[model samples]
Target: MRSIVLLASACVVTTSSSVAAAQNPAAIEHHLRYAVRVDGQPDVAMDLLERMRSYHVPGVSIAVIDHDRVVFAKGYGVAAFGGSKSVDSTTLFLAGSISKPVFASGFLRLAEERKISLDADINTLLKSWHLPESKFTEREKVTPRRLLTHSAGLTVWGFPGYALDSAVPSVPQLLDGTPPANTAAVRNDTFPGARWLYSGGGITILQLATTDITGEDFPTLMRRLVLQPAGMMRSTYENPLPMSRRGEAASGHEQIDTPVPGGFHVYPEMAAAGLWTTPSDLARWAIALAHSYRGERGGVLSPAMARQMVSKQMHQQPPYGEGYWGLGVAVIGDGDSLSFSHGGRDEGFVADFFMRPASGRGLVIMMNGVAGGLMGEIERAFAEEYGFGAPPRMTRTIVAKSASELGAYVGRYVGAAGKDTVRFDVSVAPDSKTLQVYNSAGRR
Candidate 1:
């Protein structure tokens, strides 16, 4: 069982802290800290190494963008735990769902060239396999626009990736859910263009359609259209990575000490989740996208297409929060506060990147472990250090309670709202003054 410390807040408040206007890259790296700090302990900040150890993350790579340029890129810890090989700016990690926005950028380039229409029925461009017709597609056919915006009502949220020793399925076979394919057949489960529901299955379909239209493989198409133009030389959509580049790849970790079998998994669903890249390369991609958005010439996309790529296409209300879904990224805030962001999670890797194109400021953090929460901590640190706005911190005061008082609040609790229901279990600690809470998922 897991235990979590419970804090009771007497009041809620939001306040911004002021930071130095200018800092060198080395100073910024030295201040790579945590969001939490004791009220009276200004010097008590958790450093990157301490947090990395606490989160069981062996390696972390970071890139910071300022004024539409990459200010600095750095890596910390070893590529694999218990190994001497240290992580550096060139170490590659799986970008996971981060591949979507990158792929979307290339797809938009094709649309700009008049090779494919965003509103056309995807099945029209699909030659090898077709999206099986259903009642959902009777009135509104699935289009590339809806797929990119995640309003196409497709099923299968993600891919699990195959072990290195296993046979990987072709994109078509994976879409058909045939032998060697571990996922279900891609299908429409709800009315088209109804609402936002993420579907990597839809992306796999686009991958096939893109190849069908261009007569070029997905990796080759992306290289020619996006990577080469954006200067992301260290990035690739090639699954299992190429043998010549394996030396630069970081191993995936299941935990602080546990490593994924055979070092890493192989993803044939390249468009959905297979992207091997460095944080520095990702930073360049973001910078290039921002340049195109500003009407800069010689970028991967035209200004008009880049603007559409970052515009809000639909509203997304997840259980945790609410946001707007752009073509391939999540749009946050509005006007001067507007930013586009995406997070990725593979079997043993987690990554995230956010950019405020208006201000030309952003940060990318990629980890070679399943420390998803740690990425948020690092983002908050960057915000505090670099003066970018971050999520509000909820500070609370600790209070001591009697054993009987704590016992009164211990038990199973249930709550319901509309069609949703939640369950939580609370118990008193051995000391009797503290309480531990567990959610329905058995996580604390």
Candidate 2:
């Protein structure tokens, strides 16, 4: 890793044109043949590269953590659609909402040092710009704990970000939803601590609070208290990355065919959707938290604080069915079965990372494409290959049928009732044992 100076974009160490054999040869072989079962078929395994091509995902970076170590880290595809620069372990990608968890870590470190309190009324700790008084705040105090848990009832689910040459608002301006800011002001609509509502606005408030209490900017405080201590040296909260380091950052793309005109969008909401980082750097942050949870301090968070950080802070379950928000990360299951995870999307970028704190096994994935659905499929492949848990349950079962039976279903079925024309193709797969249904993308 190279020392990056404080500039618009932090300069990262440039490496060779390529990376080591896609991280590991054996793993790649396994992944290619055992990719997640698409549709209802069991033997349908699409290689990662093939999936990228089909989904129009241009670049991806992945790192696997097992037994307290980053066992593998690699990149795939070109950083830009028409360019040859390969995405390697150090290539930067937007952390998106993953910044929330990282930001929570930094805020908790402040709490650990007695610089801030988790349960303190957030408005009392602010001076530069206070959270506007609302009927909601009068009923229940909006504390750091509630804010971290996203129960602060703040508005703005997320930020869309600005183009590289577009106007970028300051944190205060963003909070107030003032001129040039696209979203509404960050204020509570419901009672505090009522339920879970994903609010990037709330996280931005914490960023402001941290800045006010420490008399330091968000990025500087994050560096001193979180990134430096956790050894995430390659990551930064800086937005509109400095010009010098832009070459090392992966270019964001709409899909495989369309890259953003400026390579990537500039996010002014640094706390909620900023943080430029790599998968390897994020794995280090996850591993550090895992280590801390085991009573071994690996970074800024204390053992007790780390446990509470990932513990069940709010009981409101996410609509996804199996997860609930912790202080920052989403915890799946309960007790020893708990695993912490979070997913992020910003413009043309998508990312996700997870870890089983007790077992110290996890993976981090980042891609510079809008094909976020590809991330979940890739995760399914990795999970199955690594034996982290059972393979994803198939939605429907595949039953064998004779040639005559299969032929009966093969044909173009046209809808007669709809004003708009609708058609579907149902055909038997080459193997004869399964059927292939052409989806909206026309892929079987």
lDDT per prediction? 0.80, 0.76
lDDT of 1 by residue, 65-166 (tens): 888888888999988888899999999999998999999998899878866779999999888888999999999989999999888998888888999989
Regions more than 4 Å wrong, model 1: 1-20, 23-25, 28-43, 402-444
Q: How accurate is candidate 1 locally (lDDT)?
A: 0.80
By lDDT, who's the top model here? 1
Q: Which residue window of length 10 is worst by lDDT in model 1?
A: 6-15
TM-score, each model?
A: 0.88, 0.82
Error of 1 at 151 (Å): 0.6
Taking the tens digit of each residue's C-alpha lDDT, what string does model 2 give over 75-109? 98888887889888889999888988988988998
In angstroms, the error of model 1 at 6 is 16
